[model samples]
Target: MGSTVLDVVNLIIARVNAAWWWASSGSSGPMPL
Candidate 1:
């Protein structure tokens, strides 16, 4: 049970980080891309 919860939390964090990276990439200027 605890492992399942931890796995879910890790997945959530990864998704959040990926979303943040995508958003920041879009928001950055062309120089960064």
Candidate 2:
């Protein structure tokens, strides 16, 4: 049960990081197709 909760937290963090990276990349330059 504890491990499952940790897994969920990690997934959320990864998603947030991906979103932040996408936003920063968009502002800095054109995105790839």
Candidate 3:
């Protein structure tokens, strides 16, 4: 049961990291005309 809870927490962290990465990368550069 503890293992399952740890797995869920890890998954949530991974998802949040991925989203933050995407947002940072998307805004780091300027738009092209």
Clash totals in order: 0, 0, 0
Off by over 4 Å in 1: 1-3, 27-33
Q: Output the number of the lDDT-best candidate.
A: 2
TM-score of 2: 0.67
Pairs that collide in candidate 2 are none
lDDT of 2 by residue, 1-33 (tens): 467988999988988777788787775664322
Which of the two candidates, 2 or 3, achieves a greater TM-score against the reference?
3
Q: For residues 1-33, what per-residue lDDT tens digits would candidate 1 score against the true structure?
A: 467988999988988787778687875643322
lDDT agreement with native, every candidate: 0.72, 0.73, 0.71
Better of 2 and 3 by lDDT: 2
Native-referenced Cα lDDT, model 3: 0.71
Per-residue lDDT tens digits for candidate 3, residues 1-33, read: 467988999988988777777677875653322
**What TM-score would you give candidate 3 relative to the actual structure?**
0.68
